[model samples]
Structure formats: C-alpha cells, structure tokens
Target: MTDIDHELEVKAVAALSDGPFKCGTVAIVGRPNVGKSTLLNHILGMKLAITSRKAQTTRHRLLGIHTTDDTQYLFVDTPGFQQKHLNALNKGLNKTVTQVLTEVDVVLFVIEPMKLGDADRKVLQLLSDKTPTILVVNKLDLMGDKGNILPLIQDFDLEFPFSEIVPVSAKKSLNLDELLKSIRTYLPEQEAIYSEDELTDKNERFLAAELVREKIFRLLGDEIPYSVAVEVEKFEVVGKLRRIFCAIIVDKDSQKPMLIGKNGEKLKQISTEARQDMEKLFGGKVYLETWVKVKGGWADDARALKSLGY
Candidate 1:
C-alpha cells in the first residue's frame, strides 16, 4: 500500500457516485500440481482451500472472499485442469476449470519458475481474451538464480500478453503483498460484492468435509487419496460448540483399512487434526466424529459421483 496507490483508492471511491469500494471476481487457474489452491490459501491469510501434494485435491469451485478496508476480492479456487488419466471424476473436475474461467473479472495464472509443460500450456489456452491475467511465478524460494527469472517471464510474455508478471513464494509467504496489489488494480470500481466480514461462500459444513478430505490426502499414500471422498453426515451447532459427524468414502473395501490404519489409529489422527483445523476456522469448539465407508466404484459411477458431491 504505497501513498500514491492509497490516494488513488480514496479518489476512486469518493469520486464515484456508487461508492469508494472496489470489488471483483478473481480466478486462480493453473494445471494440476501447480500450487493454485496453495496460492489462494496464502493470499487470503487463512486455509480456505484444501491443498495437498496429490493433484486434483480440489474437485469443486470454491469462492474465498477477502475483504480489505478498501476492496473486496472474491477469489475462485477451481480444480486443476486434468490432462492425463481421463475418467468421469477427472472430466467433472476439468469441466469446473473451464466454467470458472468464463465468470471471473481477472485471472491469476500461477506456474512454477521454469517448469512449464504441456499441461501448463493447455491451461493457458483456456483463458479468455477479454480478461486481463496476471502471470504469477510461484515457488520463487525454490529457485537458485534470481537473475534467470526475467528470461523466464519473457518466455511466457511471448506466448501471451499478460497484464503483469509477479514472482512470489506462497509457501514462505513471500512477495504476496505485491500480488494482492496487482490483483486489486484490475478490479472494477464498484461496491463490495459480499459483506465485509464474510470470508467465503461455502458454509461450515462444506469446509469441515474438505478439511477431512485434506487430511486423508496428506496422510494416505499412492492412489488411495484419489479414491477417498468426504461427506458430512451431520453438522450440529450446540451453543458455542460444534459437533460434526463425517464419513470418509473409499472406492474399494481394501482402501478402508488403509484409512482406518491399525487399530483405527489413522482415522483417529485424521479426526484430531481435522477438528483442530475446524476449531481455528470456526473460532469455536469442534467435536468431530469420523469413520470410513466403502462406496465401491463411486468415482466411475455417475450417480455415485453426484451423491459424493463431485
């Protein structure tokens, strides 16, 4: 927030007849495993998006609203565009990516420094011509040469005329202030779209389910995480305490034991971590109950996928 930028923000608000607020939708788009959800979580200063090392952790479009004193940014975190391992689930996730691109006011195309691949190019192709995209070079802390960043930016600059280029490290919380400012500059002069205190469009139930799924992704191995889906069977708010009952859906019977672990230890650990996260997110006491259920071939079944909220 420079002095000049602050002054411009003030003038844009009072100078306009509507109000002195700026609000717009921002879409964070990138290929699978490119840290799109991580960047969104970092920008909002909270863990609204569920991120894991495994790709396709985010299956649905999530709107995380960050309201500053002067502007409100509705950040849409979409599932990564899948190019490999085509299936019904992947198809739905890929459809989510393209659908969100058409609805946002601006786009943040996050990518690694020099690891651009075919999937990255395919995501770039999905961007609409009318929208101004900021090419965010994420994971800057992983790079050894700071000087080579310019050439990397130029390489992408030739592919598409980006509005601006910002290099940031989402994991280390580096250079994100600049990224936020860059995103705000593209916002239109209008009143806030959502209430100032609202953080996301999703309810607490959705977040609890996603949190459970995140732990499953983080703790599990191999293809087990992909076969897992979380459903909140019950969400009860009693006074200041919240009691949530959740079910972890697995495609096969063999995968059930992996989530439950020996003596149900893995499920216990997952519940404890998820409850702690829910406590932090809700600012209240959370009592979470979790169990594993076998929903064979839910990923491939169309009706089962719909029931699982795919």
Candidate 2:
C-alpha cells in the first residue's frame, strides 16, 4: 500500500470513535464536470443540483440529504476547482469550495476518468492538512480500462494520504452503494443535522432561481453559460399558480443580442423551456418572465458576487 493509503486506513479507523452510528455532512469536491452534482442527485434520488454540459454551472454549495431508518448523510455539492480567475464569480466559486472543506465530516475527492493534472493535485494538496478524505473517482462509464484509471490513483497517492480510493459512475448509478458504505464507515455518527423532511438546505426560492439558471445553461450553450447569472426578482404563490420573475444577468450588452435572438425568438424559447421545468418543481403552473441586463465586469467584482449571495 502507498503511504497515503496506509495513513487513510489508520485515520478512518480512528475517526469511528467520534460518533456512535449516525453520519452528518460529507463534502463532494473535484474539478468541473467530474459529476459531483450528478452523484449527489443520484444519491438523493432527485435533482438537487443544477448540472449541464458547461463547466462551473454550479455557483454555490448545494446540500442534498439522504435518510434511512437508522442514518442520515448530508452531501454537499460544491463548484468545481479551477485556477484563480480575475472574475469575481470564479473567485466566489473557489471560496465556496474552501469554506465547505472546513466544516465537513469527510471530503469526497472526485476525479473524472480523464487524466488527472495540476488541478487535481491542488485538491490533494489542500486536503492533505484537513479532514479524512475519500478519493472518489467519478464517471467510470466513460472509461474503458484499468489503464485509464490507474494513473489517477497513482497520481493521487503520490500527492497525499487519502483515506479511501473508490471508483464510481454517478450518472450510471454504479458502485454508489460501496462508496456510501466506505463514507459511512469513516464518518463519526451524530444526530441528524437537519430535519427528516428536509432533503436539501436550499429553500424554494433558491431552488427556483437555480431551475431558471439551469434552463439558461441548456439553451444558451457555452458562450453565455458562464457569462450569465439568475436572480429571482419575484416569487409569489397565488392560489395554485406560482408567479415568478427573474432577470438573466449577463456581463455584456452583446450577450443580450444573442439571448434575445431574432424578433425575441430565443428569449421566448428559453422562457418556455424554463417555465415547464419550474412548474414541475413548484407542482403548479408558473408564470415566468425573463429580462436581460448587462453588468460589465461583474465577474471580477466581489461586491457583485456577494450581492447575488455568492
């Protein structure tokens, strides 16, 4: 066994004493598109996190809870780790990841099948000092052989002492039982941190805003995906229908041209698609409206991110 592996085994065994039989928070950390959100959703058996083909779509730390007769596991989905960007949005994403690490019972170090690099190394370097980390290799379905997976394991081993290394396909629902078992084996048992009825810490308004943001990601593709943010300007329940209004905040006026398209066709399409998703989530009809606004360089400004509750 590598030194890190041995160290992890020892650490996991030791942490068992911190609690009797219940588990609390487990933070999922990895680079973007590594399926951290997918895993959390699959484990929760619902869509608690917004996911798309684009990177950094998840701007905040989303918590999904799993409960059984005997235990509860609160899983946190965080923004993917990336190099520090000049944009305030990117900085806020990085800050969210670091802050989650501080309070987690265990850290799931998610790695995609693609070759691990300096970004992956940076995660190991950060976790080396805090929490007993479980190296969770996600997206196994995309890979064909042990050869593709072996290097990631070795690279991680070379970097830090991870408590456990387990491969899983969050999208395909593969090997998740083993992953959960391994995670639970290490977490100190504690009272359910949240109520049994609560599936996530995010309220209805936050979920509604994210639903709208996910729609934007789906319709706009790459160019506008990173440049946009969604805010719920109005969310009120009138009888059975929920009336909601949100602004699709963009970084430049040029994006408004693209988002609206010819004769407002694109905006109409986005609103239609977003309204359907919101209706399902709200369990009632949703009257949705999208207004476009450009805030130049909001990406680099901390004040902007904080204002958006980043």
Instruction: Give the number of the best model, judged by lDDT.
Output: 1
lDDT of 1 by residue, 233-293 (tens): 9999999999999999887888888988889999999999999999999999999999988
Q: Which stretches of candidate 2 lie over 4 Å from their true place?
A: 1-20, 146-155
Considering summed lDDT, which 10 consecutive residues are worst modelled in model 1?
A: 10-19
Judging by TM-score against the true structure, name the best candidate. 1
Alpha-carbon shift of residue 299 in model 2 (angstroms): 2.2
Error of 2 at 180 (Å): 0.9
Local error of candidate 1 at 208, Å?
Answer: 0.4
Clashing residue pairs for model 1 = 13-20
| CA lDDT of each prediction against the hidden true structure | 0.86, 0.79
